[model samples]
Target chain A: MFDDRSPIYRQIADQIKDDVLRGVLAADEQVMSTNQYAAYYRINPATAAKAFQQLVDEGVIYKRRGVGMFVTAGAQARLRDGRRERFFAEVLEPMAAEARALGIAAADIVARIHQLIPGDSR
Target chain B: MITTSALQVRFGDTTALHPLDLDLPGERIYGLLGRNGAGKTTLLSVLAGFRKPSAGAVLFDGAPVFENVRSTSRICLIRDDGMVGDGTDNLRDVLDMAAMLRPAFDSGYAAELLDRFGLTRKQRLGALSRGQRSAFAIVVGLASRAPLTMFDEAHLGMDAANRQLFHDELLRDYLAHPRTFVLSTHLIEEQSPLFEQVLILHEGRLLLQSDLDELRERGVSVTGPAQVVDDFVYGLKVLSERTLGPTKQVTVFGGLDDERRALAGRYALELGPVAVQDLFIHLTGGVP
Candidate 1:
């Protein structure tokens, strides 16, 4: 499932976050135990546990003591808000740089975006 | 836990293993990687108390390993060619023998594994094919339930489906009963994901030991214009380099620091992550 060059735990953490952002994993829904995740992914349980621990530390997920992990309340909204800021910094910034290097004007970039995106989406 | 201090193995005039030390914690899966003649089998055998070290100390937990009944009982090393009994031995009797020798042996589990592998008790060990024998080794190794189980290419001749079954069964069994497992195999990429820690042996020496994830991050690949790539990797530990027209891809032995990353960014060079198999090849003299 993880094909990236990043650490497996980091890939898993990002995947969980993606799932949460896409509404595949709803807030307040319990996630699979690390062992179950490991068995499903065919990886070491320790790697899965590391990813879960990262989620728990970030408050994206919480433990219910005896029960398994669950997405924290408002975690989706919080994550989306955080990602919105990063998208502009990491993605838009590089795109703007590339456009400038290619001698494309800011207005032309906006025009191209308009041609690709629907008017109602704005 | 398993510990070794300056362990060495010598046969006749040649040294199979130089002085080496390893302290492995309990209940984690470790992947042992090396080319042939890298002393992988020698290391596994020593760890399992099957072969004596010519020099230095071997410890299982806190006790001496070689010939120590208490320590030896906790280990099970399955060699590809060595089963529990002679070739004429019936499969059923082999399980009985394993159950008798290993205190943690689970006959019920063994039978279940055998059934899943499509093997029966009526067949003699000699009558089974090579793949079947490997499957049988896996059955015994997993069912032995030894606290420290080592498989030296135990999946040697099995078909891909059977190998998949072995990995799946191993993961499930390990989840239920946690124990230290040392798997020595040439099938690096296929089995790399299942390891928590990785140990690479080279020239009978302990080359590197690290968390599997950390090891993955150690090797970095950069692809850019040939001239720029050549200038960029100057003085860096370059493991291997490939050139296609003007674009050159170089695999380096260490992570790129912030300065190096900035340099790559300035030139628009693509930085790619290295897989464990690629790193193994570069590190073990397997790649030209």
Candidate 2:
């Protein structure tokens, strides 16, 4: 199911990007056609096509003419770097702010972070 | 392309549809939504050439649709009453008639759909259950492959699972062969996503018509402390509002631009998109 906070096409593009960053969709691998994705998700084909167009515009995927769309070379690494830059502002910042509101100190948050990732140094 | 210009229909003293103008291009599915007795059937019937509009015209590619053989053959309307005729006819007879009358009807596809829906060729129309009758109607609709197909509450008798199956099959066939499909139904939440555009009818008038995505973008819910929520929603068209203790949630109708979103972020407000069904309910005054 998709949420309405943004257009479904934008969400579709984001999901593909996440897959690329996680290496679930390897670079140069053929992606599902717009029709296939539309059928799978029970959405309009045009909506799915819009998502594909956005991904193509971002250089995340490229069309192989009649065959289908394929993940562009280095798409995974590019997505990873972009996500890394956003991780702090989109995830950590709000989380740290929530912790502060709840009277948890920065040191305590750091210690909890360390507890979660035992081998990592902050 | 189907275009209606100032179209209106009246029965005796009651106006079923007020003068309305609409243009529906080919190759896209449209959702026609309205409450009971909202003139949805009247509009579709006019489009299908089953009835003549009292005023203005319903045109298919610049030609009038009413009583025109060329246009009527290309337009298919399947109503909830199962337009397959009386119960005396068997499935085979009905399909045979469809093949004889409908130029685009595919008999092979009809057979495949019958088998998929667990229907038999020898079964009489009267013997099938309500759900099966609905399924058979869908079979006729899809296999007809008419350029402009309209299903007006055709799934009323179907169960939730069967309705979902119908949606899937409709989408699959639509993708395989693109055409114009107008679905008039009360199941807004379940079917709205399948539509590229949606037209809402209220009190025999065209209330709103827009791309589904654009309609979705018009509604948003902002929740935070009462003061902050009030400040953010001020001067905006607020559809509905709720308050619990010191927290408030306001559903507003309009695009949430970046500046307004940033303002919400500054206030730590939780902003979320409103579902199409919820927005519809709010727009229609929660008549249900």
Candidate 3:
């Protein structure tokens, strides 16, 4: 659900990114044209274009001169890198802080991490 | 933030709204769009507290807004119809009254707008041209500086040049001090650029709410041989099409990949951007 609290373009960009992650949109695949998206969703075309432009700027999508936009060749990899860069603040830091707050020993946490690894039954 | 829930309004037998729900945030510009009699004016009036909803309520930051001084004073609705006064009053008196009542009013801006529109303060309301009256209302709108500003087709009487001036000034001022602005108009192509978000009403019902950019990318126009165009558009959501002799023009919605583009190009097909107005017509046209 979209709340009016944030700019709609940012939400649209986030949704497109989610679509990429889910493989609903594939690399080298064409993305929707701004006007189509606008009519489909009944939004202003400029806001829709802003979302696509954001994706293009981040190398997640690219435009062909006379043709429409396509998902970049390494869009998934680029998105992975972007996500990895934010992992600490977005995931690890909060988990670590919570673990520390629970008074779980560092050794125990390390052992748990090791046990959770695949093919590490021993 | 402004929130409306199950908001229904009726003007005698004409139902203006149909139990609609919407949430409008502060510090941004919104284009409220619809055809004539699409309830745009009625909706805006409810939001600005000019007219109360027959059923349902409007809340500004979790509080009722109708006749509520604290919230009402922060808003100004510049309607297409000139602002009404208690009784007969000259244009000069109305401006003076606005200066006295609206705490945020900018007299300098008001003067400048009047000068730009070739309007003199001494003219009586009954004596001004329709275009001149519209200009005066717009001047009040821009100068009011209300946090939540609503302009409901305020430039209907303006010529192209003056309309452009109003748009430019609106953007310049909005960029300098961001606020919640709701502009309801039918001229989508002419004023689409200034809209950060768009809310569309269809037959007094909420049809769509979306960003302008996304709407642009969701559709493409393809023109080529009828066979090739038909083949290319196959399985896509074709909004509209026209064919003449061997050529066919197809406007379709959905994402089209480079492979498809290449395939179409191989058949000598031409692909291009669809204008906002055309796209809107295709999407909101009578045919489902």
Model 1, span A1-122: residue lDDT tens? 77635689999999999999888999899999999999999899999999999999999999999889999988899999999989998899999989888999999888888888867456
Give RMSD (Å) of candidate 3 vs. truth: 17.9
Candidate 2 per-residue lDDT over residues A36-107, each given as its tens digit = 998999989988998999999999999998999999999998888888899999999989889878998899
Candidate 3 chain A lDDT trough over 10 residues, lowest sum:
A1-10
Question: Least lDDT summed over 10 consecutive residues: which range in candidate 1 chain B?
Answer: B279-288
**Which one wins by TM-score: 2 or 3?**
2
- Candidate 2 matches the true fold with a TM-score of 0.96
Where model 1 places Cα greater than 4 Å from the true spot, the runs are A89-122
Reference-based TM-score of each model: 0.94, 0.96, 0.68
How much native contact recovery, as a fraction, does model 3 achieve?
0.13
Error of model 2, residue B43, in angstroms: 0.7
lDDT of 2 by residue, B121-167 (tens): 99999998988999999999999999999999899788887888789
Cα lDDT computed for each candidate against the true fold: 0.91, 0.90, 0.79
B-chain TM-score of model 2: 0.96
lDDT of 1 by residue, B90-127 (tens): 99999999998899999999999999999999899999
Which of candidates 2 and 3 is the stronger one according to lDDT?
A: 2
Order of quality (TM-score): 2, 1, 3
Quick one: ranking by DockQ, best first? Answer: 2, 1, 3
What TM-score describes the B chain of model 3? 0.90
